[model samples]
Target: MPKAQETVLEIDLKALKHNFQYLKSKLQPSTKFLAVVKAFGYGSDACKIAKYLETLHVDYFAVAYINEGIALRKAGIKTPILVLHPQAVNFKALIENCLEPSLYNAKILKEFITATSIENQKNYPVHIKFNTGLNRLGFWHNDINFINKTLSLTKTITVKSIFSHLAASEDLNEKPFTTNQIKDFKTIAKNFEKTVGYKPMLHICNTSGILNYPEAHLDMVRSGIGLYGFGNSEIENKNLKPIASLKTIISQIHLIEKGESVGYNRAYKSDGLQKTATLPIGHADGIGRQYGNGKGYVIIKGQKAPIVGNVCMDMIMVNITDIDCKEGDEVILFDANTTAEDLAETANTISYEVITAVSQRIKRTFIE
Candidate 1:
């Protein structure tokens, strides 16, 4: 890739392919792969990422909302898409697009069934979500009987898969909790199959679960962060490549004398002669205000230039006094080398927040 003349998020298809293959290698031949392309493909371009993944023969695609699934359908994605948290209002639209919904609660299940019946649809696929431990969504274990009875009353909708979300599959200390969640999911599946008289696919593993719990990789595994070049641990990160690189160029250079202040509210005061370079990226571009005041730094000519002062809406100034750089020089906010994980650590957050927070306004260029 050439030097970036303006703020841009470069999505690397090669890296995505490598990550997908790497994750797939960990699964059994019988296991299926569901690529989670929600949150704009983790803040990259979802349509582009999904298109590339489709060529890789990803078994399925998962999105958080009906609109997201609709977007993929509009983008010509034909693979099965599971809407993880679809709303009742969009059940009609969801069915029209052939998007599966994860019915987590009685209310939603009832509404979706009504919608499907009204649409004169039969055996329309839908996923049943069980609340193993996430508490975010999904039905309780006791609801299995209710779900089965409800399903018995209608043939318009069929259970395509039964799934759950792991709360802390990434932390070893949470091993007990994660294993329990998996165990609970297995119990739920057994009861569900016995009640429903047939088995739908069972999947509960996310990216971290895929790495940390091989025993739980039941029928399929869902990967979001791992597909985006993060494995949620130092060891796994070495095997994966970050797919997005945020780059910008120096718009201006300034020389500040002692006692000179920079940015809003005079957040940064130079104690000595300092040189700073302004880059056309800031909070509006996902480099949040928390990264200011020497918390975060950008790479310039192989050197680290600390971000000084507060981050403005559309620009940030990095101290470049120790670096040999000039206006129009390429600046790396985060890349494979200076990763988003590394940058996120400076602000006490995770890589997901950093990457997904990247503003959609930023130009997204892909490396095919």
Candidate 2:
């Protein structure tokens, strides 16, 4: 909430709560919800988001790294945290913080077992990641025997959950592949339960997975983008409300004659008697250069203003020939009306990059 900050990210906690409710209503009575707070809660604010989710009684919290879980623990988040990708080097810290790690390989499993034994821990919770199809990070189907053998040797460690990632859950065209992944995952879970004598909390559905494949929501659903408001599915996005809006101020205005150019490299030439407004946000604030040269736009007082030239490190120009706007006019990068998908299409990227790449330098204002 400091002054003079040109760009700002406004977060709607109320909208977040609404989205949570929507997802909750869609869940079966027995299913649990695990809020994904990794990547700074997709660049909003992890601590704030986690605090809010805790109030709503979110079943669990998820993070991509051990440090992120440690931060949540320090913030007084008592809910169980599942570390989706924790390394062996941070096992001590993870244990000290009561954070769970996803043991995807025998090496990591052995290392965690040793670390816990050194601490004299009992039944320390951890997750097992299976590489059903994503092949990104997890033990393969053949590694199941190796996992069972290792677990049999250790009594201090307990399997908390076994999960996998869905690569193409949003595309209906890939229903066969998605279904196959679910099938493989279920097979692994059955075999794993037989070996371990019980099934750990099984989870596989991401945001899109939850919408497109509800049956895959076995124990818990890890929701990331959907919680921040974009479900990436046509049907789900319709019900989801955006939680973040980028806003900036018009710092100056210029009236150029015909053939006069603007911005670096003179990328854009004024058509004729054109007026341009310069905004106080640019690439440094996650407004990339790809949005320059008439590729992007901003909303000035609810009126569309087309971007003019190359987006600079700290500023971007918008053509406002017909709009009446002062130097201090408010401009919106994207909001409920202007979807992030539109901005992503304009920038030649995706909505995930647009929302997650927002720089931390910009002030974040939360509204309930």
Candidate 3:
């Protein structure tokens, strides 16, 4: 909670716990919780967040790739890890690390089976992803028979779960679409259970899906942004708390004479006499160019200072004319109060883009 002396991402474990519990409260007692700690725990800190969540007994963890799962394993995470997208080349390492892979298509499924067999493994857990409507990944509903027939040929790999992704569960106007997606998944699960001769675990809900579709809670629910304190809606946002706060200190202050331009390309020219404060963070640090040219602002001494000119590689100048602040004073880019969502709105983006865009170069401080 101390003032930041440099650009840093402050992660509050307490807020994480609150968000986890808040989302967990919405699920059935028997429903499993899979915390998606991918993207460096939404650009906070994955290993630290996963370690903390492990203490709370989170049922499972998911990552976007194999190395992310490996990182969790390296961190001594004992809970099951599901790699959302696994490459064939890393199947050996995945098995070595005991990370389960989500086999979405026939090619990946076949390659993984071959890898498992070659490794002399038996019943290695794997998740089956079906493309209900997302059309991004996973097999089709008709591909169930292919998946079942393929699995029957090999005893080295076992399906641990059958799941799908909802296209837009957070948007109420897409209720019909989401409903149909859920219904399709249920059909796939049923057919899969019958053909495979047994039922693996079933899940299809993401963070927003968890809040909007309780009926589709199924056997497990995966949460990514929700655990980082975003609910995808104004009303639901009130119930969750964002855990990461991006803070920095003013490196210097400049008095701009009227009509003087600032930063590269002279993107910003002061119309009148103004005071600008330079902070040690910019596009390289994850405040993208879209947020430049007056689109984004930082909080200084309880006031908003609009960003001036184009964002630099490692710095940004904010108009601090009226703010009573000096060099070394603390500034907030985004936090619990002035959230990433609020800032992203200025650039026509979302909280996920802003938070996950935070560069790894920035120092991360944890508040336990």
Candidate 2: list runs displaced more than 4 Å.
Answer: 1-6
lDDT (Cα, tens digit) per residue for candidate 2, span 167-202: 999999999999999999999999988876877889
TM-score of each: 0.99, 0.95, 0.99
**lDDT values of the candidates?**
0.96, 0.89, 0.95
lDDT of model number 1: 0.96
lDDT of 3: 0.95
Q: List pairs with backbone clashes in candidate 2.
A: none
Error of 2 at 242 (Å): 0.5
lDDT tens string, model 3, 1-368? 68999999999999999999999999999999999999999999999999999999999999999999999999999999999998999999999999999999989999999999999999999999999999999999888788878988888988899999999999999999999999999999999998888999999999999999999999999999999999999998999999999999999999999999999999999999999999999999999999898899999998999999999999999999899999999999999999999999999999999999999999999999
**lDDT comparing candidate 2 with the true structure:** 0.89
Q: Where in model 1 is the C-alpha error above 4 Å?
A: none
lDDT of 1 by residue, 1-368 (tens): 69998999999999999999999999999999999999999999999999999999999999999999999999999999999999999998999999999999999999999999999999999999999888999999999889988999998999999999999999999999999999999999999999889999999999999999999999999999999999999999999999999999999999999999999999999999999999999899899999999999999999999999999999999999999888999999899999999999999999999999999999999998
Q: Residue 325 lDDT in model 1?
A: 86
Clashing residue pairs, backbone N/CA/C < 3 A, model 1: none
Off by over 4 Å in 3: none
